[model samples]
Target chain A: MKPIIKIQNLSKRYRLGGNGGARYATLRESLSGMMRAPLAILGRKGRASRPELWALKDINLEIMPGEVIGIIGSNGAGKSTLLKVISRVTEPTEGRVELYGRIGSLLEVGTGFHPELTGRENVYLNGAILGMKKEEIERKFNDIVRFAEVERFLDTPIKRYSSGMYVRLAFAVAAHLEPDVLLVDEVLSVGDMAFQKKCLQKISQMRSHSNAILIVSHNMIAVRAICEKVILLSQGQLAAAGRADEIVPLYEKLMLENVKTETVADEREEGMGIIRVKSVRLVNRAGTEARAFDTGESMKVVVEYEARQRAVSVVAYAAIRRPDGFICMGTSTRLEGVVLPPLEGPGVVELEISELLVIPGYYIMDVTFYDENFEFRTYFLGRKQISFQINSSLPSLDDKYGVFYQKHKWNIDDVNVNSPAHR
Target chain B: MGLTSNENVSALEPAVTKQTATITEASPIRHTSYQVPDNPLVVIAPTKSWVALNLGDLLTYRELLYFLIWRDVKVRYKQTALGAAWAIIQPLFTMLIFTLFFGRLAGISSEGIPYPIFAYAGLLPWTFFSNAISNGSSSLIGDSRLITKVYFPRMVIPIAAVGAGLVDFVIAFIILVGLMAYYGIGLSLNILMLPVLVLLLTLLATGVAMWMSALNLKYRDVRYALPFLIQLWMFASPIIYPASLVPERWKWALALNPLTGIIEGFRASLLGYRNFDWKTLTISAVITLIILIYSAYTFRRMEKGFADIV
Candidate 1:
């Protein structure tokens, strides 16, 4: 099948300084500029000497029907710029994009919603702004209201609604857009957990219609859940593009590398040369250092530190965080009521887990050493210093829905079963 | 399974190999037998020259235009104590002030008609024109959120603002009708020219509004300069005075102001004071068309930069 969307040699350039970079030029400056160089004003060539930054450069890709692609990048990586170019909200500076059928872009929810208008009115208004015909909105009006779950207050002005209801109504209208190609930018990060889940379900349902969907988001879990293909962008260039499982991990590593450089500056200023963490290692049950582990396997974290002074009443803290900034597990010596001996020289601290239940993905460990009372001063602080991966050999354990996998047993009518009979 | 092998190969080589492998793998599945649908193909590229005014898109998005106009009319009177009454009150109170200052006190000639009715007739269209342009000039900046988030004909926003002014014009027309009855001035055959004159006024207002709105997006000086420009414009037109007051030597120049013909045409047709000045009306119509076409082109030229600058 032919690709639904094709982008060829696309690039976008933005000027850096002077009046050229200003969002809007004042008439005074423009008049003076014209006076200074009358010929330049006519030719519009005065800005050629200014420094320029390319938001996107030579990005070439094709998207087929029935495909959901994820665009993952750090901030200012030109993810949103590419979406804007495709949506035609802004003209490209070079190259072009060819699109088949109708296109809908949700760069933001509630694009044209008014505060004084009621929910019903805003639905029609916002739908029109999103390029939906009036008949189309009328046809799906009930489903939109049902999905939003705001039937009781449909007549009330949306300004009177709670923030959660407003977001649901806004996202509801956006979700009902039936275009051949859809561009979404971090719109899933709205509303409560249940509403977010409902939105994800609605988006996943769009795939069955064979529509091409492009999602640019910072939420790794959502991208991993719904996107079949993923592309990584760095500094306005395509870095990698492949299956979601492979590219998402590579994107996370790139993110970690960026974080490592930024934290290196902070470490030098705060280390104070008193004591610091020299190394952190993750080991398996066999006592060999390893970076990968299976679900329900025993794991150990060893922290080796050097102390320049005799430090007493020191508390050790460690936290395991997912790539999306969710803390999966946290532990501390103070919370466990363990006391450590005074350290005047290099020593090692070990944290052992009998069984690690985290779901299969990448994880980061943060270790810190605080003085007594867990305040005042820190001997060592390592943020995102040690990274590891958890794998699941069992196909049944390959779910990405939750943070941890709980151990459980199943029985039917008091009879033990290896798996559920329903399966 | 394909990803696993590709990963192993990438691990041995460099990162560039992974990109090529993914592209090559995805490119081989093209099906030549697949039939492409008849959907419209849109090309987005950098605009280099003058873009054609794709008025067909205006026809396609007519419903959005209606909704935008409806929203403006609905939200304009919200939270106000007087509601839609403010529409009639604006022109009514302006007429009263002019009657006091320019008619009763200054004894300005109203072409042998009652000063109040003649001034009210001119104020009806004048108020609409001023309101439309002042509001329309700021419409694009006011709807900046929509401009950046979606792709629609940018012309709809200013047109909607101008369209919403008609509702107020109709409401104020009722007062003119009541005043015409009190003066015992019956409708004449020339009344047929009323619709034509109003269309000319609308076209002229829409043109100026579109031009100013597009300029306002780039310079922002239009916003501050607009109200002052309107104030001076009212004095230049024949709103408070009759066109006959201008000496005959400068009557041709006075007709150059597009509102001069419309306002004079409104008073002459509605009051049966004189025959329609076809010469002035013809000039007004021609100038209105010129401004409309010129402004439409200027609007299209500036539209490509709105989403970026706004």
Candidate 2:
């Protein structure tokens, strides 16, 4: 079968260190550079010379109809650049892309929304911006308002609407565009949790209509839930491409390997140069050391340390930091009102979690050993010494909405007796 | 990870292909195939030589163009207390100042018609031309978000900016009609050519705007320099003063500036103060067309870098 989209040897190069003083070379630079061009050329004859950075290189992929592909990579791995090139937002420096259908790109939410315009006006304006005709927008007007749930504030200027309302209306307009090929960036992270689920469902529904969807995101669970095929990029080249199950784990393992190396070499071990952490490992209930854990599973974190000084008060503290570099949770033995005994030459401490209800994503662990006196002075601070992954086995789990899942139950007590099914 | 769900797609793949194959055989137009000979296949290459305008693409996006213009016009008056009254208020006050300073104090000649109507007629087109150019010149830079994120004819941005100015021109033109009614200066068959003059002015303004907007994307100095350029251009045109004040031998030189011919043509056709100069209007139209084509070519050439530079 012929592919719906074909990309041939695409590449994009950018000038380095150019956007700071100006986006491009100033007139003065051109003049001076012109005068020194010949000398510079002669000086560079014996050396390899170029200041260009290739954001994408020799990438070739064919996408079929009714397929959803996830593009996963570390930061600056050209994932977004590949999307921009395919969306025609920017031109590739080399090669070509042949497309067979109408393309609708959602590089950002509320991309063309005007703050001064009413929400009703923005819906039409945004619809037009996405290549919807006037008649089409009019036909979808009621559906859009209903989906956004902003009927009461339709006439109000979008500037007055809350941020949540603004994103809801924006996504509603975009979702109804129904292009044959949908290119979505990391825009689903907006809105509330239930709304994010609605958007994911909307994207999947678009796929059932024989449309092709390409999504780029760092949220592994989002890609795992929606994508059939996955492409992994590393350093501006395709590292691997296959099914998501095959690629996501490889990508996760690759990321964990990089973090492990950094953890070993980095200067995160901070203290008075004594009683430093030797190793920290996470062991599941099955007694196997693992870097990843499933939600609702018990796990143990073991910290092994070497202490040169004896008879000194030391309390082990651990903190979990989200990807945005904020500490989400932290705990210490002293904080829990348990006094630790004096440290010896070598020791081990274990912090066990009954059930890891945390959401799916990568997280950094900061383990430190502080004095028992609750003073601000620290005996040792191990910063980013270990990292772990908490994945959800539940199919309904959404990682974009929040970092943790709180356990709760719902009760419905009152019901009118109409049929046995009501009970 | 939906590891097992992908098996369902692989299971459904062959049936889907067979379905598409039969549909393509039945109706080629309705089927999805880039291989169809008559269906144009768009190949987006990294680098290609600059081509002339893709008028078909621009035509298809005419609705978007309309919406953009509507958005500009709406946003211009959205938060303002006076709303669109500012459109009428602006030219009226400018005309009043010119009537006082240039007509009374400076004793400018209006030929046979009243000075107020003469000045009003010239200012009508002058205001439109200036506003269109100033707004159009910054249209691309001002809409950096849309330009960088979306794919459309870059010319549409400046064109819409010029189109939005037409709303204000129509509003101010009503005052020109009122002045003509009060003065009892009847219009003749020459008044029918008013649209042609408006078109010529639009082409001229669009030409300058295209050039300025493209330059603004690169240097950004164009943003600061544009207002001063428009001020200088306004004085050079014969809005407050008559073109007759220039010596006839140098009238050819005055005609070199397209606005001179356009403003003089408006005064003659709208107010009948002087005989229409077809030769001057013809020369202005030719110059306008030439500038339009040149600037359009330059704009298309520079558009590829707009997203990168902007």
State the C-alpha lDDT per candidate.
Answer: 0.82, 0.78
The digit string of per-residue lDDT tens for model 1 on A1-423 reads 677888899999876657645778778977987786777767778767657889999999998875679999998989999999899888889998988767888889778989899999999999988988899999979878877889999999887776677888899898878788889999887654577787786776554332678999988888888887998988889989989889987887777566545432222123544557777788898989887888788889898888788777777778877656556898889889999887778989999988888887677777767665322223233222566778786666543457787776677898976622112
For every candidate, what share of the true interface contacts is present?
A: 0.67, 0.44
Query: What are the clash counts of all predictions, listed in order?
Result: 0, 0
For B197-302, candidate 2 gives per-residue lDDT tens digits of: 8899999999988988888788777777879988888888888889888888988988889998899999888887567888888899999999999999898878
Candidate 1: which stretches are off by over 4 Å?
A: A17-22, A39-45, A264-423, B1-35, B38-40
Evaluate model 1 with DockQ and give the value. Answer: 0.27
User: What is the TM-score of each predicted model, taking all chains together?
Assistant: 0.77, 0.76
Listed per prediction, chain B TM-scores read 0.88, 0.87
Candidate 1 lDDT over B18-101, as tens digits, reads 334243254434222224465538988898787898889888889999999999999999999999999999999999999999
Interface root-mean-square deviation, each candidate: 8.8, 7.0
